[model samples]
Target: MTSLNEIPARTESVELEPLREDKKKIFEDILRYFETNQRGYIKVPTGWGKTFLSKHIMKKYYDEGKLMLFLVSKNNPLLSQAYYNRKKNQPLFPNSALLYSERRVDRKELAATLRALGQKKGEGFVLFASLQTILGKQSAEIKDLILKFTDLAIVDEIHNFINNRGNDFLNEFGERTKILGMTATPFQGVVGNVKFVDEIAGDMREIYTKTLPECILDNELAPLKYTIAESSEDIFEIFDFEKGLGELDRQDLFLDCSTPDRLKKVIRRTQLAKDVYDSMVKQRHAKTLVFCAPVRKRVYGVGGGDKEINAFHAKLTSSIFNGDISAKKLEKDIEPVLPVDFKNYTPEGKFRDAVFISSELPKDEQNAILAAFREMGKPPYVLCTVGMLIEGFDFPGLETLILLRPTLSMRLFEQQVGRVTRLSPISGKQQGSIFEISDSIDSLYQRFGEGVFSGEKVDQVQMLQPEIRLEELFSEGDAARAIEEGKIEIKKVELGLRGKGKGVKIKEVPVKLPPTSIRAKYFSRLLALTEEKDVGAFEREKRELMRAALKFRVRELRDAEELAKLAANVNKLKREAYEDRRLGDVSRQHKPKVFGEVEWLLKLQALNSLKYEGEHLSLQEKNRILKTLGFEPDFRKIDSHRLKCLKLGSAHKTIPELVKVLGFVSRLSSSETYQFLDKKKKEQWKRELLPAVYWGFCFIEDSPELKDLFESTEWDRRVKNIIRQK
Candidate 1:
């Protein structure tokens, strides 16, 4: 059984047992996300015990025996971790399984095993399986188990397999069960990546994110000593549109970097970077993991055609690059840079051609090799991969990291650097180290290392763009143009900005370009706009003005640029409201008579001639009706009909927000006087009019009607059909 201490970073919050303040905060955030039924990701630095926090929160939330945990993964690594924690937190999950690749278990066996432990309602039970096993091998059975029993599915690393694995689950499960996605970073790549994340888990609010610098400063992660080798100018020269690739190639860049010179430059810079780190860290660069440019075989297709290309991308991201270079040549480059003793290279611990894995080694030899490469005092002091080791993999001896992967993706770059940033659990190492081969990938080290500060006093966080794919490098982000083309919008932000201090003041901050589906653009634009003075619209209609003012008052609580754009979104919303009202108005005019929620529909029903709905009442004459109803009863003073019509129209003009406002007054038709109708007819009019009057005049909770329409249901479908027609 893994002890509670090992499972979660916690303490008894008292004098005898001190609490881990950071972990406590993180755990509380997780609890809030769950309590709110939120469905998004939270980020914690690599060494901030993210796994432990997950365990801690899971224990807290699973106090209800009704909870059935579903662990979603590609492999059993998380499953094993969960198993250990479950053991440590026994009775919390008395029934749990750890099914890995080598020892596979079918869903039947899994289901039976869980049921055996607890068949009663509220009995705690869980099943753990890799997404591959559940979605691929035991897909049908797992689906049955999920549909029949599972309540909440806790997915690990959604950013990884969400497009496919997540799609499979969502398609089968629908929205019948709830989902929780856990990851170190919330956002992934720019276009396709965010789309997938949004598809599976993006709808969920971003509960919390603990920045890397915070973790490092707090000693949860080691402080990184980052160094850049090649100047940005030299690095930029490789992708030089003027030198390496012509403007034509730049116009349409391929997945594989087309320019041979550029690829060679990447390789050379990578080698140089390795040599620098090896000299600095005292190794053959074996312990240093290098994140390289993603090596894909071909173009990435959205609908799944190029298999090998996809596999290469996945494999590169997984960090098992196996290739070698000339040892003699490698030594020649580094020998001049450092003294002879700068690196430790022996026959037994020599820098191998292929660093991460070599199938040539026997099982025991391979195990020992892995141990040495990962451990502090072992041979083969460096290792390398692409985006693979950014998260999940834990190794304390990985003291230094060399950045060979020239990337523009800020999130990817941060994640890669985060590899070595963790405070090694075993070594108690105080600092992590990073060597940049080239900082040309948009000044990777400078911006990340020294975060941009706005004011000396104001403490506010401005959002930054996380993903900058290589594709974006080829073209200018013309988001403003897109906005003009109606591809983007300056949405009115509903910031419940509360509390006050002369928050962040934006002075001379260059306004960021409009968001091109990139957070940087939105964040930048917002920061500038938030500092603006002009806030409200004076030209709006009464209802519009009232709502917009309410929205503005709420916004003033915080200092943000989004408030500046509030009127634009408000205007758009006002247009929509007007259109809905117009639809109802038009439907009334075209109708033959009046009566219901639509004033026009009600008017059609109400304006009937001799229209009492019954055998005896239907036969009543209009003169008799007028006399009995006491409506212009004398008939000679009957310019009274015009007077009654005027009165009804004026009454319906109030409460524009209430959709059926006119329906109540439309019932008071001059043509259909009520006095002559039989008792049954009067009763019928009262029966229907009472509800119609209630809908238009009364302020009921279901006034808007849209709130009651939960999409795809019959009522919602009907409302949408009416909206479309209108």
Candidate 2:
């Protein structure tokens, strides 16, 4: 077994070269960060092609004749995976060799191997080893080799190296060569004032920013539907090994705790997975992976001797390969103990599916099994393991994940969920499903709650929300026009009266003002009308207000001129009231300005009403409108019902008249015009129409006038869909 303390020393210096397009981008970014800051971290999410990027970095320095050392975990699976990934994709490092205790070639022999490869016209050499082998008996040779040849050190899973007092690897390695530590999780516990590189840090990296829910909605991964199994007691009770073995002596409890109970649970949860796999096999068969926990428990007999019990243990000691039995044959006897259901169950073999139960297998055997499985052209439908399938396993065909383990760590949860999110080669869709069976709903909620868990923050700014809202705001013709003409002014103003007091002598009175800006140009224009004497001028204002009330509005909605106009209007109106000759019947004398103000306010009110009506249409109603207009209800062509209604004039009170005008202007057929009239009667005509209205405005690509009508929105999905049809 490999111990954590004994890390091997890196010996060979490999010169690497850039190999792939994506790798080149990563290499440039890493080099740029290194040059400017001296140290930085690169966190490419698993399956984002980290190996290609690493090879590219190696090649860049190798071409410069600089020596580089690649440090990886001592596990055979990880080491072998890295070696093969480099060999197949990156041929520049032909001199790369594996370093493990079992294959411990002496220094002189290794030097010869290096020299042989060095003579092959390569830029550099790479020495691979387990960390235990490096720090143990091979320490002296490895240290000397590193001091002699190493220029740059690349440490994988660098997060594991922190906080160890005796481990001088980081300090010593940093003293000589540039140290780059790479890990999916970079932060350990809080250590004040320790400078380190981090690609993802703080609350920004949480699930809120990159949530599982959002991933499922976008079809980046399959959505998870959970089922809870009721338990009499906590599952942790079964794992309490500290209690005396005698406590489990009860026959009834023992029988209940047998393989049947556990198997039943597994069967219920995995039934869906099996069904999905079988369906895929029947149609277009594809590879799948399944993971299960180890089933090994120590049972103490009445005689006080402990015996290991496993589902496969009985099969290891008995075999009937031959009819004859001999004393010498007993030594090599082994039984074939398949799972209890294996005898009754038969795989159709339509989809090539195999099972690899990895509980007590030796490390080498486990690695060999995984390697063999990976090499298969049509591998197993399900690759099962305990913890092995959670990380470092990348398969693009993996489109479904079944989670039997319940975890509170969002990091671990996401990592496990990510196993099957790789894009499918056949469908070209990055999709997968996660099925979790657990009784702990609270645990699930807590794990995915409103804070950071497993190194990912849950408060990330929502990308879709902002983009969608922007698209909606700018999709309207008037809104877009105001934005393009720079007519919209979002600013704040203070309201105060400098000249008079009601029914009293004038006195110096100071007042504080509210801090808010006017956002709409029409509102600003209305405010300007307050400065004019004739209230009729305000009524004749051509601009329209999109929002309902100036009060209780967002600061972004107000403009400076609008604020000034409001203050001037109120002040002037008040003065006119006091200056009027009629005192007793003042209402009758100043009724004109009041009515004028009300008229302007009503126009603003009407515009707001139109906006509200536009938003109320349903998808079916919008679709009906499109169909009536002799256009197919193609979502990609026009996704918004609001925009459709606005185009058809079905959103406003005078929609019939408006539709007639549109028909005459466009010379639309009578049938098309009649269809537009019929569209208004559809249910949910308002709810779905708002988005359509916004999108339609955004889709008028060539018409600058129409384009100017939509300023705050972008030509995004909703608009693009409409534009595509146009």
Candidate 3:
């Protein structure tokens, strides 16, 4: 083992940006926060020089004889790889002990470097390692050397590690050191579950946040523009017999992207992009990164959605690696591709191989792909990937992002676009363009409308949309002419821009395409499906909201097929929204509310209704009682309050909630009244309280008052009591 004295440090070079204010501000802010704070976070978008910011902070502390531990999650080795590359290219970045994919020499250097940093008090050192490696399988000595030597830990991708594994590290770090957690999308971890950023970062005190637009204004990040294509729903619905094909979730996306029909669609679009960019933007094959969604199948057999559509898929996965048996079994349906993690299914319903097309590349292979893509003379000039390159993979030469897959998450959509948004020197990349193939995401379209084309001003930092320009790939007139003339059309759009800050915002703008131009008239087959909506905009939007709510309810119950089928047709959805009471037909007992809102009144009425027989109460009389309690009685709630047994309305709940509540209510004796009393014997927040005071799974959360009344002394043994009640 190398000892502390064996490590050598190169003379730390001068700062990468000695005079850049944007760079200086980050280091200074971190330093200021570190002075008094023990743990905090800094939020920075990707490609906004996070490495540069990290370098200045690390260098500042190292020079002052303070040791820093920069922990990056292994899942995102791109950060580690990125930092290492920076150290090689930028002279000012410090020599840190990087513990990711290490060669023998690299390991020796790390050990010796750590040993050296441990011994020297005045000499500064920064240790870089993944959370899993340091704490996952390391020996005690290695762990001790890391913990004891570090004064402050600057964690990149802070949200990534805010889980149980992250807690394991934080538990060890404790009060002995300070922590500066950094992430581009802050407060983005588990929404329902406990959040790590909230717990560790604590309101991001002493933090500086700048938007993509602001960064562009400072020339710290590249400017972006967007173009759109029609949704893939039409083709997939018509051709794909597979269930739940258009959902845009992982499995749906994977199945759509890898299939022959869909793959051909994506490949064609990519080629078109290359041809268009070459003719329009530059005289080159548009260097592109095509983000392909994976092809997926159930591990065991047919999936949940499969059963809904009566699809009993054949066994295709098992015995594949063994090779002969799986190949023979799936020979009819699947053709052999590279025996990588890709699978093929045939027209005859047979699967060819156990391979999966969209399965993630192993780290070694992923790193290799990244390395090759970085090479200027590589053949895969058009690199295709799924989820890996969304962030951290920095290829400035990448001029275009072809979003072949759809994403709903705004953060995800932004990160995918950011991949091409790097200003490149070697490839002479000036700006990154995003080709959105579908309107599957609202935030994406909204960003284009509000932030880009409409030029609507926004004040909030969160709303400081990146200065993106969106153009109609095919104008209405162009589409009409293309249809009439039987010609191809390529859609091009541009927006004029002006600089407001740092003289960088208006440095360059994409030129608008002129009418009567001789450019290729490229059109997607998807155009045929883009008929204007029959309903007016406001009515259509209202109907969609109602339709979405019902779909959400169906989804909560795991009714994938119903939701998928309902989502497929607009007219059908509109009819359902108008006709179904659970949707927006509010005249019915179960009135429409927000998607997740509980049908409290309707639910309680369905559970149990006991007639207050001793008092001769009218519907109006009982309605008074419910009104006194601040609940406006629907006629059902009032009438149900008068019944002795539970009403049948309880069956109306979505299946899961209905089943769970039924089971819970059945066990509760009719004699036990729910109580929420302030008395010492029965304090507030007791479990008996009919209105739920505690939060839990949405199903068993009952109404303020339950139903069912038992008049018999022994309910099961009461014939006389039953006769009297009747």
Candidate 4:
């Protein structure tokens, strides 16, 4: 087993050339495009220095005595870098002034700079501001002042501007002031009904284009390599809504649908922690970036008096460290900038090679942390973050990217993977390595298509799946049966049975248990049995194994019975309350009606009808139904109908038509045709029916009444016929 404590010593690094020669040729081509077009944006891969190229254009306009306005989005690192560069008196853009909310320059001085630029006296001065600041209602005066003085505006990462605010900012400028927008992926996603690429194409022309594969071929970026680490444990075994319904009801699982997403997140974090630690052990000298799952804080507003805890972040960080240390000392060492409500819990670790950063820290403090991480000989070589380091941050020597966060957004995945593609030949870094720690890669490829790599082959690394231990398998309720059935593999064992004075029998047996300390304990017990001499003692020893096997079966049966009884109680409650009303109305001279635990479905149907009719049920009707469903009536800001369905374990089937189909299943479970099938076949039929109905209901909704058609003997055939016709 690979352990966290077995990290190897750091290897020495080698030095190489500062910059690749091909950048000069690429730069010359881009310069020619800009000179001919006068005003247009160029598409360059990340780490190809779009900032450097944009600055080149800015300097040209500066030399010609034209003032420029440079805009970036919020949370962008370029804003901080520009601020730092100006403070350090760097040559990049020394004559720049900031107009963001955190500006340190006096308004009088800003006004003076704008006045000088407007009068053509401040020849080289430029203005930098975030889009939020320029579009703010409070900054209307300054916004007007800058627009009047600026001759041209440069927008970085313009794909981020596919929003109402971005459109509003662009609308303020005209052809008198040239608008140049730069981005790597303008066609990232759709804004409302239009693609972002199409929406921006009308306003900006593509001056030059460079794809990721082209960049690699031209030696502009390092070649890419990636790996997908698969977790041995399956998440489905931990959760089964139907089989665990009774246990789930006791815990009120359906009341909050977020439970499933939360469980997946925690499990994903744990798996990533192991693989990330293993990767660090393999590459002790590499500069690595780890993207962790978002920090999830659970706020206890009632009993704890409004307290918050960073549950997953703390767990993941401690798992990565995996060291022996006092919880208090560990907590104090890796303290977060913001206060947490960890009344009884603190993470334990003493690992100092990694540093965690988030937006909770002040901007200046975040900058200082990044500066320390950039030091080659520093103690902290790995930087862990949730989302603070994905965009616009340039670290050419970063050689590895460990992705612990799974994303469905193509734009987000691209930005994250781009972090390590920068060339760092000076630090002996040749190829970039990406470690994808989850199963989200397939969906991402399907969504974005294979052209994401631009024909660049991404080599796969085969990671060994973690081992399975006997204790772990035995402790798991579902997998315990595999051990008793001799399905698991254990090392061979030999035992000697003594029959007479000098005669002895030896037998070799293949034990069916996973390799673990528990296997050794079992083998020791078996050896004790083989040494028994007396008949009674030998029988007693043999019965011990049988007793242990029976214990597991008994526990499994008991759990099933408990779950069955709990489900019965829930159904009885729903049926009883509804039947009482039905019987009461019958005694009062009304016709009796057939009923079951179907009021929730009826309520859903009534709501759907009312919504379709452009109306709502009376308050009395709503409260009456809600009260019978065991929820308080007229609760503030709560969706009563949806909550009722969730509590009843039918949250996903919310549409009236689907609810009606489930109610039909409840009715059919008691019908003659359904009762005629054998137990095993009946279970298989039900499992097939539900998912089939869920996926095919739209095609067969108008074919016939579900109850009437499904109640027949040939109901399965009718279902297929109806679906095939559509």
Off by over 4 Å in 3: 1-6, 9-15, 75-96, 104-120, 187-196, 201-206, 231-252, 256-281, 298-372, 375-379, 439-726
CA lDDT of each candidate? 0.40, 0.38, 0.42, 0.46
- The numbered model that scores best in lDDT is 4
lDDT of 1 by residue, 1-726 (tens): 222222221222101122388668766766666665646566565656655655555554354544455465653545665555343443224445545555555546565544543455454445555666665655565556665666566667666655566656654554545566666644444211132244453355556766554555445667555454543334343433332222111111122423344433434444454344434554443356655444333322222344333222222222222223322233445222211111123367664433543333355765565566776555455554444455555676677766554543334555666677666667655566665543343322122222212110011111112122211211122332433443222221111113374322211111222222333233233323322212221111121111112111110111122422333343343344343433345332322111112222112122121232212232234334444333443434333442343234322433343344323323332224444667886555433332233223222222454233212122222122222211
Task: State model 4's lDDT.
Answer: 0.46
Q: Considering only N, C-alpha and C atoms within 3 Å, which residue pairs clash in candidate 4? A: none
| Residues 1-726 of candidate 4: C-alpha lDDT, one tens digit per residue | 222122221132211123335555654665575554534676766787777666666666766667788888874458656544453344245566666766544555566557756885536656777888777776666677776777778888887775567756765765556767777665443111123432442445676677665566556777665554543333222222233222111211111112434443344434444444453335675777777654323421212333333333433443354332222233443321212321111344322566666666667766776886776656356677766777787888888777665443345555776888798866668677776543322222233232222211110100011111122213322233333333222222122335555432333344332222322233233323322222222222222222121111112222223323322443454345344543344332211111111223323322322223212346555444335434465524124554453344332444444556645554455445676879986655544344334222322233355434433333343233222211
Runs in model 4 deviating more than 4 A are: 1-39, 83-88, 187-194, 233-269, 276-281, 295-311, 322-351, 362-365, 440-726
Worst 10 residues of 3 by lDDT: 516-525
Question: Model 2 Cα displacement at 388 (Å)?
Answer: 2.2
For each candidate, what TM-score against the reference? 0.48, 0.44, 0.52, 0.49
lDDT of 3 by residue, 1-726 (tens): 323233346575535456377567667877787777777777666777676667677777777777777778754455455345454553233555555435222454455566777786787767666676676444345566777777888888777665467756765765658887777655331111223354443333537766555555456666555554443344332123253312322222333333434433433433333333333454244566666544444222223443221111111221222132332233353333323223333357443322222224466654554565566644334455555566566678777766655443344555676677567778776667665444222232332222211111111111211211111112112222322332222333322223453211111233332211111110011111112222222222222222112112110112222232322333343334345634222322222221112223222322222122213346665454344323455547543342211222222334334444433433332324323323643332121222221111122223322222222222121111111211
Query: What is the per-residue lDDT of model 2 for residues 457-534, given as tens digits with 9 covering 90 to 100?
Result: 110111011111122222322332333333321111122234364311222221111122312322333334333333
Of the candidates numbered 2 and 3, which has the greater TM-score value?
3
lDDT of 2 at 720: 27
